[model samples]
Target: MTIRAYRDADLGAVIDLWRACDLIRPWNPPAHDIAFCRSSGHGELFVAEAEGRIVGTVMAGHDGHRGWIYYVGVDPARRRDGLGTALMAHAESWLARQGVLKVQLLIRETNTAVAAFYERLGYAVEPRLVMAKRLDRGDGQKNA
Candidate 1:
């Protein structure tokens, strides 16, 4: 598989891969998340291709002091072949190139199965409370 930056045409395939990998959540609309990542120059969406098919994707970006990764997915048929690891390496390289000093990512509370994969990549479980407020609904309107 080959890893590279995302292109406009890859949107559908990427979204499909994410869904197949159980990455989509009702509260987090994929369309809006994709737009937020693509609109700002700080983020990048990387995709993996093999046999001319998109099989994996990772979105990485920096908030100046730290880099964040989201939407990591690999085709179910393509998992266990090191594709996920390679995609992560690519994302880390992209962040490092931008001078990001640290990297972080959030895994859903119920998705504990992926913790081992991340742990193999040297990411440890951190003790911190992740608080959030509704900026708006999925429609992109500001909360009143």
Candidate 2:
């Protein structure tokens, strides 16, 4: 299989693979395709192709300080073939190139298997809480 940077033409297949894996989270809206493709940073979306078909995908983005790994997915039929690891390696390499000091990702608390996967990958869980507040249109209008 070949790993390469994503083009607009690969969006459809990438989304399909993600949906098939049930990997979409609440924060990942349907419009992430547009946002991801247009984002400017040290990160990029990559695809793993085999036989002219996209089988795996990952989005890796980094500022100078930290890196994020998001939206990683592998086709069910193609799991256990090391595609996930290969994709992660590519993402890490890209982050390293950008001088990012640390990489992090958030996984659902219920997904113990996923946590274990990352643990096996040499990532550790930190003792910090993640908090967020969604500002609605009303709030924006008030500020305006």
Candidate 3:
């Protein structure tokens, strides 16, 4: 499989891959997330293509100091093939080019497997909690 930047025509397949990997949730609409990433210019979205199909995806960004990774998913059928790692390495390289100092990713506490994946990639779990506030409620306006 080859890793590359996401394309406009890959939306449907990317969404389907996310769904197949059980990465979609009600609160975070995939389409809206994609649109935001594309327009906000805060990060890059990447995909892994195999046999002319999207088999994995990852979104990465940097805010000057540190880099963040999100929406990382590999097709269930293609998990052991290292596509996920390749995607992440690509992200790290991109972020490094942007002068980012550190890279981090958040995995649900219950998702031990995912945590392990990053651990294998030289990421260690920090003694910090992830806090968030929903700024958008999907109506093209910020939440009050």
Candidate 4:
């Protein structure tokens, strides 16, 4: 598989991959997220293509001081083949190139299965609560 930056044509496939990997939720619309990243100028979305198919993705962004990763996913049938791990490594490398002081990603509290995946990559859980207040009236099941 080859990893490359996302293109406008890849939007639908990328969103479909996220859904296949159980990454999509009602609150965070994938299309809106993609549009924001592409328009913000500080974010990038990468895709993994194998056999002419989009199979994995990793979205990385920098908030000046730190880099954040989100929307990481891999084809369910393609799991355990190091695709997810490679996507993460790619994201970290991208962040390092941007001079980001730190790299962080939020994992859902109930997502115990992936904790070990991040932990194996040297990510540790920080002792901080992620408090939030929805500013958008449309926010219902805020999955972030």
Highest TM-score, which number? 4
Best by lDDT: 4
RMSD of 1: 3.3
Q: How does residue 136 of candidate 1 score in lDDT?
A: 55
- Residue-level lDDT tens digits of model 1 in 55-134: 99999998878899998999999889999999999999999999998899998778888999999999999999877657
Query: What tens-digit string does per-residue lDDT give for candidate 4 at 1-144?
Result: 999999989988998899888888887899899999979988999999999999999999999887999999999999989999999999999889989878989887678779899999899988888777667866554436
Per-model TM against the reference = 0.91, 0.86, 0.89, 0.92
Q: Which regions in candidate 1 have their CA more than 4 angstroms from the true location?
A: 137-144
When summed lDDT is taken over every stretch of 10 residues in candidate 4, the lowest stretch is 135-144
The residue pairs in collision within model 4 are none
Ranking by TM-score: 4, 1, 3, 2
Ranking 1 against 4 by TM-score, winner: 4
The C-alpha local distance difference test score for the whole of candidate 4 amounts to 0.90
Question: 1-144, model 2: which lDDT tens digit per residue?
Answer: 999998888877877888997876555563574465447756688889999999998888875667999878889998887888899899888888878879999876676578766776788999887875557444533221
lDDT (tens digit, per residue) of candidate 3 on 31-95: 88888777877688999998999999999987767899999999998887788889999999988
Worst lDDT window (10 residues) for model 1?
Answer: 135-144
Residue range with the least summed lDDT across 10 consecutive positions in model 3: 135-144
**Candidate 2 Cα errors over 4 Å, as ranges:** 33-37, 136-144
